[model samples]
Target chain A: MITVNNLTKKYSGTTVLNIDSLEIPKGQSFGLVGNNGAGKTTFFSLLLDLIRPTTGAIENNQIKVSESEAWKPYTAAFIDESFLIGYLTPEEYFYFIGELRGQNKADVDSFLAPFEDFFNGEILGGKKYLRDLSKGNQKKAGIVASFIGNPEVIILDEPFANLDPTTQIRLKRLIKELADGNDVTILISSHDLMHVTEVCERVVVLDKGEMVKDIQTSTETLQELETYFTR
Target chain B: MLKQFISLQWKSFFRSASLSSNLFFKILTIFFALYLIAMFTLLGGGIYFILEEKVQKDPLLIINQFLIFYLFIDLVFKYMMQKMPVVNIKPLLYLPFSKSKIVHFSLWKTILSFFNFIHYFFFIPFAVVLIIEGYPPGHVIGWTMGALALIYCNNFINVFLNDVDAVFYSFLGALVILFGLHYYQIFDVTVYTAPIFDALFNQPYLVIIPILLMISMYILAFRYFKNILYLDGGLQQKQQEAKTESFDWLNRFGGISVFLKNDLKLIKRNKRSRTAVIMSLVFIFYGMLFFTGAVEAYEGPVWRIFAGLFVTGGFLFTFGQYVPSWDSSYYQLMMSQNIMYRDYLNAKWWLIVIATILTTLVASFYAYFGLEVYLAILVAAIYNVGVNSHMVLWGGAYVKTPIDLTSNKKAFGDKQAFNVKTLLLTIPKLLLPMALYAVGHYTIGPMLGYALVTLAGLLGFAFKEKVFDIIEKVYKTEKYKTIAAYKQKN
Candidate 1:
């Protein structure tokens, strides 16, 4: 669980993200939606404490995100490509993530087993490194590795942008399954309204650094998103 | 369309110029230009003076040998220049220009590099001196042109070979074979160059090989345009192998395992950074060679210890200077994660310790080689732990150069911007250790003096965490300054 209160961030005198209060319960899928420069990414970054907030605080699993030692073992995030070590192969990358999380090596291999067909030995247990793989494959590898150790909270920024349609649906299904079965709270921010509606139980619409709407996906129709997007 | 492409190239080049002209670039330009001129002056003046009187008798042999040597040196420079990160220019590919023009421009830009100065600084001066001393003007011009052409050819050839990965190794292989042949006198290149030299000094037709080689280099460089056109080759695809280090070596120490991994990675991947490791070892070798003579010359164990420490640890401080820059791109991610600044700083400390330990081992080998250098190594190691490590740690913590580790440029920060503070710190941190050693030789003698160093180092180790915290506080407070130091366009 995560709670952000009275959070504000500024860069060069311009407010980039401002939040009064927000909470993400355990075992739920939360979608963050915004147009370009809408502070969605900034909000995610704040929750992870990547950058210090101008004011206010965040608590993840009861530990203050900025001040305490929590969120390390219980949370994982892929803010951008910097999160991925480009030199390591997919298998090696996952193993690295596994080791960092204190998971056994076999656990990593078992987790990767289902994706073997998609990976085709191209991404894992192969001569090819992550740097050599195509962009889609690299993204898939990064996504899979981010989920290593089954953290209580997983935050992914623009998780489906570069993926092919088939992989997109597959990943969506995978995310839903993880949120439903493993009791993992997942926060995925993307512009794809259809994708968000399909997987996320609730969606937060942000515009110009402020949260404009927080609505249950079950109640709000797809057409309602057009208003937030246009504004 | 071609006109549009050329315009685009021009704009891009000028944009790059703006970026490069940052304060860092200006300092680098001044330093590099001065250093280059100074080095060439020393080397060129020495060779020219040595050969000036002899060239009147047999100038061709001398000129030819010089040309070959120039070509050899120029070839190494060419390889380094070609490897510089023009790969980032891929963003320009989406612009309206054909890839062919971009490659052509890149080849043309190579001539602008500083390596072309072997002709201007060394050969032209030799030619001028020869002409002034009564060699015919035509012969002098021919020789100068030939020498310049030969250097250009070598530069182009190296650039060409670098495009295909096979070229560098093949060039190395050919060099080895040539060295073997020359030593055995089976085929004497010096003898071969005699006629060309004679033609240049006595006659003027011998300039043809250099002329032809120059033309061939242009052709080869043009051919490389095709290779650059299709940038996807096995060269770029060379992947990093997964590290399978047995941390049993470092893990026993506890909390140092991650640092061990990072240290190993830095050596394995960063070619320029690997130099720090090799340089430390080379100094150790030099310490062994110079120890006896140095002792005889100075007649003091203190002098020996001072010399050993400086020689062995010359490259020490440069190790941690790029700490933030090395991880700048991912720092946002790492910062976001559960990683504490303290743990991050501790990891860096461990890397320094590992490097220092490795240097000490090399120093130990110097002891085995009959110099009693192990005592000096012990002293140096202690100084390294007690003083040098903190010096570097603080220096690195304060350094702001956000180095791109993937680039061919050494350290990836500013090439020419050495801070006065960094320079000032070196005097005391490095020289004081030697000064202390020197004082000890008179006051206490070698054994006691060396023991003093060892004890101080051990004590420093005991209180290292406290020292690190103090450094960390300074680092945090000066983080913005540090960022500016790294980011200032050097």
Candidate 2:
């Protein structure tokens, strides 16, 4: 569904990302694992066409991401708090995103019905603007918003970092359910090995903008990943 | 400890990434500050000469008579414009620093504020002149001290009252009531003003009244702020309720309306944007200065056109120029969304139109001045809705600097990117209507002049779709550059 061809991004002559070639087939749950300064966000930003790649191109569904706006219709991302409108309440934010994606207010309300427990009653109807919400709650709002339009391609950067243990478990289950033969391509970057192993069918390990390992997940994938990290 | 606090403030001022990144703005600001100091110094030097020659009464008495008015104006400005000095007290809270000491330091800093000293620029020379005019030097010193004490009194009162949201309305209400009573000749403040100040000046020892008042007000404000210095004090408790509200009626406009609703909430909730709205409302009365007989009986309708346009479209210049940058906080999300750029531009256009209409309605009361004034305002409002709205939106496309909504600074801090281009673009937007009015008046007649402006507006309204198309194209072309710029923390 997505193709990267000799894609490289640089800032001030220093390469931040230099993926020679990569592809994710349709309906795959792909995991990106990396530590700080691993170019995870830069990669995602390139895919979202937020920043230009110094060389080559990214194609979503055979359409060049930079050359066309076609991919925007089916792609949704929640990379950071910047993705959420700070002034709007969570509900208002959802309704706005839903409206942008051709869903009405009532439709969005219904779509958000299942995430009440995921929200922990701290988000919707909480009277606080998204900015005023705790960081974890703000992350939840952004994640929930990415799901509003039933987007074909979803990208989330460090979704589990700020979430509490309970919400992390819920999010893992939510990701698993959404990825189960739903024809939705999910790209998630996380440092937590256990959750990534549990949710993603395949994991790609990045080190300094270079993809080091492309491993298909199995029962022993978590142990293997842990071993790689310790080394 | 006070030295430590002052050093931290100095570091924060000079080392801020926003300030250091923009050398041009820093230099501009320095020059602006210098210009203000120079103007005040010049005013101080000239005030004594002006007052002595103009006033038939005792110059000191005349100065005292106007002192009350000056104090009133000073109080209003302090309440509106002065930001309370803030430090990151969180680190100090857990440290060995005493709360009273910290509060004292903060309050003491206000004494050295430029606002307090600017008054002396005018008063010092006046007092020196009084001394030279054979007035008792002690009496001159006493009255000057009294005036200075009153200024501090105002400063402390404002510091105490600033946090109470209702104080703004009450202050406005009191001013209106006082002016209304005086205007209707029901109560003459002037009748008492001379006697009261005369007594204070004659018996210079009575300066103790203002001195005492200043001390009490200082104590009151110091105590108030100290009580709220704790982490979970009234400051945190006063976090505005975050109730969710949907403008259901706006949903009829579909996706564009959502953007409008968000913009409305932005203006309502943010301090800077709220101030802009209030300022626009206050400036509706700016037309009163121009609607006088002198301007009306002047050779041309230029002043009328300027006043009308400003009154009606002032909000556009204040708020609209920053359009999408106002959403710079979330410009990335907005750009990534599955919405058309046209809808966003359309939403901004509609907002400007609504504001112009609302301001024009309020300013229609200027009809009390003259029917011609009212007609000029109507034409200008129409012109604003039609032409200037799109012009401001076009200006928005070039505003690459992101406005920090969370910053409590009076103006948006990122000034380097918003330099000459902004002024140059805005100049034509202001002057076009006036130019059209002049041409129509000079060539045809006054009635046709108004009609010509209205026709221009109608033409603009008619071609709005084309304008939106051009704006959308501009936005699309600049999208990547703008997003990258917004990503910078500075």
Candidate 3:
């Protein structure tokens, strides 16, 4: 389980992310939704310890994320292109990430074998560096590389944003597979409420750095999210 | 259309993200430029008098004999240093302007480069001296104009030189062969320059040849750029074939070697880091320039050791300074990974130490300079691997600005403007070694000097674990700041 307790991040005395308490149980598919300044990324940054929180602690599986590196082994995230090495081929990048996670090249190769459909014949065995790839292809590389070591927690921010419709559907299925079959805890942040609702077991709405609603996903969840946003 | 393009470029320059930080350096650069202009002017004005006292022949004929050599050196220097300043044509390509006009404007822009003006800095003063010496103004005009046409021709030729690596190598190889043939007294390669330049003064119309040559080069450059001006052509970087190599052998060393292999790939794959690697190679031969001169020219162990330090520690100076920033493109990925700071820093230190050792081995041939010279280099290399490498990595922890690997196209890519902090950090790295060696050399003895350097290095090697702890602490404390800085748009 991940516990975010009294986490608040301020930029020049202006609070950006303020959360009193939030619990994300292991092996659950959780979704985060918000507008541009609603602090979705700020919250994620604090969770990853990429930025320091003004006042609070985040614990990942009983280990404080900032105080120790123990969480990094069991946690994986793909926040943006900053997470990808631009100069490496997708395969090299995969092998690099695999090696970091204590997986051998053969292990990475096998893990990536089924991802060909998701790669759409463009990523692996190709000469193009990640930077040269189209944005959707680069995201595919980043997202799939996050899955290499089979980390218990996977965090993906806006995974379906730039993707083509076909690839978007493929990614949704991939997320569902990890959430259900592999017993992985998945945290997804997306502006596309329809996609997030389809994949997440529970979805939370963040309004200007505060949680406004936390609801269980059901058949009418997409409509509920759409109605909230439209209003 | 040209005015609009110029205005757009001006706005981009002032509005650049780096402009605020680079403003101080810009002012410094202006003073540096003034110094060069002054030096060139002095050289031009004094050339006649200097030659009159030294050479038996007429100064004009003697200098004319060397004009081709001067032009060759000028062209090569410009090839190394000059960049076409502000004609990024990609955005302008889709505009209403004709493609040829854009190409023409780009070509015309090079004519205004400070490089072309340097010829006047030297030649106009030389012309004044000629006129003062009673040479006809008409002849001087023809000669100077012809000389400028050739220089501009070189400027245009540099455009083609950028695209053809083979041609560049051939130019270098050809220079070596020509210099070799001259060295052996087999031929005088500069035999033709005197006549061509003399003909410019005698038959003023002969200037037409150089003018024609300049026009042809301009046309060639314009046509080449125009051909590739299409949106999907040369302006768009072609996807390169991913060169894959199995680093399976490095798996034995575990995490450290993984970073080592990845860093090796970083240097191999990125344009900026690769330039740093090649520059280190160029500095390896820097010893030859001083070593080939008479022994008395640099008699002391100090100068010999100085050159040796450069010979052996070249890669350390060149590539070590930009340690973590070379990975700035993917630094967040590294920081967020499960990799330990100890492993990452140790891997970098090892890579540079290995490079120093390799360069030292290459310079062992400098034993031809004598065991004394080579031993000085060996001692310095040992010191470099042990001490200087750690110092550089320490400095790297503070590099707040990130290097944009793909976009840094400066010929001196190591000096490419990003951080003054990096430039400042290089000082202690350079001075500490020299100061340590010099202090021991001056007070105690040469043996103690070598021993001091060697001891310093050994101590650094011994305490590296302690050093790494400090470095790691700095990394942890600065983590959020580095992440935020690296995320800034280049």
Worst 10 residues of 2 chain B by lDDT: B409-418
lDDT of 1 by residue, B63-172 (tens): 56656655775675466443322333456567776667766665666666566764587666666666776768898788778778877787677665553435665675
For model 3, the superposed segments whose C-alpha errors exceed 4 Å read A5-21, A53-59, A62-67, A181-183, A207-212, B22-31, B86-88, B112-120, B124-138, B201-208, B294-301, B406-428, B435-449
User: How big is the positional error of residue A214 in model 2, measured in Å on the Cα after superposition?
Assistant: 2.4
State the lDDT of candidate 3 residue by residue for A67-122, as single tens digits: 99888987889999989988888888999899889998899999999988988899
Better of 1 and 2 by lDDT: 2
Docking class of 1: acceptable
Q: Against the true structure, what is model 1's DockQ?
A: 0.34
**Candidate 3, residues B200-281: lDDT per residue as tens digits?**
8888878999999999999998888777766566565645677666677776777698898888888887766766777688
Model 3 native-contact share: 0.69
Of the candidates shown, which would achieve the greatest DockQ relative to the real structure?
A: 2
Report the C-alpha lDDT of model 1 over A1-231, residue by residue, as the tens digit.
888889998888999888999998888899999889989887887777655789999898888876755677788887667676555556656766776677657887787888776554567656655555678887888788778887889999999988888789889888988988978999999989989988999998888899988989874646799765664
List candidate 2 segments past 4 Å from native.
B1-4, B20-39, B47-55, B95-97, B132-134, B193-196, B205-209, B234-237, B241-244, B268-272, B292-301, B400-428, B435-470, B477-481, B484-490
Model 1: per-residue Cα lDDT at residue B264: 60
Give the fraction of reference interface contacts each candidate recovers.
Answer: 0.31, 0.75, 0.69
TM-score of chain B of each: 0.71, 0.83, 0.86
Ranking by DockQ: 2, 3, 1
